[model samples]
Target: MGLSDGFARPLPTLVFAVAAALSMAGLELAVKQIALGTAYAVWVGIGAALTVGWAMATGVEPASPLKLLFIAGIVGCAAGLKLLPSGGSAAED
Candidate 1:
């Protein structure tokens, strides 16, 4: 799409872009308060899942069983990190 295209100019898209940027900032803060491994995994997993979901929902991309399963795997791994007893706390050193 061109820079001035109608699809590119939507307010919601701009809002979402801003939200995504803010979430990245939040990820940096989270790494300071929590273990980097856990924070980074959750940040990347959530970002990927949301991006795929939005693409599918908007019909920008097609959804298939495998795609859904893959997203589930990503989110599950992130959840697993949070459940680990040692990884949820602030990092040492």
Candidate 2:
């Protein structure tokens, strides 16, 4: 969304670039402490849930009970992933 909105706007483009860079950096740091698959799933799940939530909040998308339920499910799954063992010791980080 940010990237699409940025197509002819300077500020939005810059913001999108910075946000993408930061997201990647955070993902890189996360993989150091967790399994790659778990980290990636949590990262993508949170990002998707938040994006949809924001759209609903700002009225860019219509809000519905089903949407909210799915968002909760996504959040729950991400949290569950975090709770699972990573098959590595914390000291490995």
Backbone clashes for every candidate come to 0, 0
Identify the runs in model 1 with alpha carbons over 4 angstroms from their true place. Answer: 1-13, 87-93
Candidate 2 residue lDDT tens string, 1-93: 454563677777777778789889988988998889999998999889988987899888999999899999999999898887777755675
Q: Cα RMSD to native, each candidate?
A: 4.9, 4.5
Residue 88 of model 1, lDDT score: 32
**Model 1 lDDT, residue 10, Cα:** 79
Each model's lDDT comes to: 0.80, 0.85
Model 1, span 35-54: residue lDDT tens: 88779988889889988998
- TM-score of decoy 1: 0.69
- Residue 48 lDDT, candidate 2, scale 0-100: 91
How many backbone collisions does model 1 have? 0
Clashing pairs in 1: none
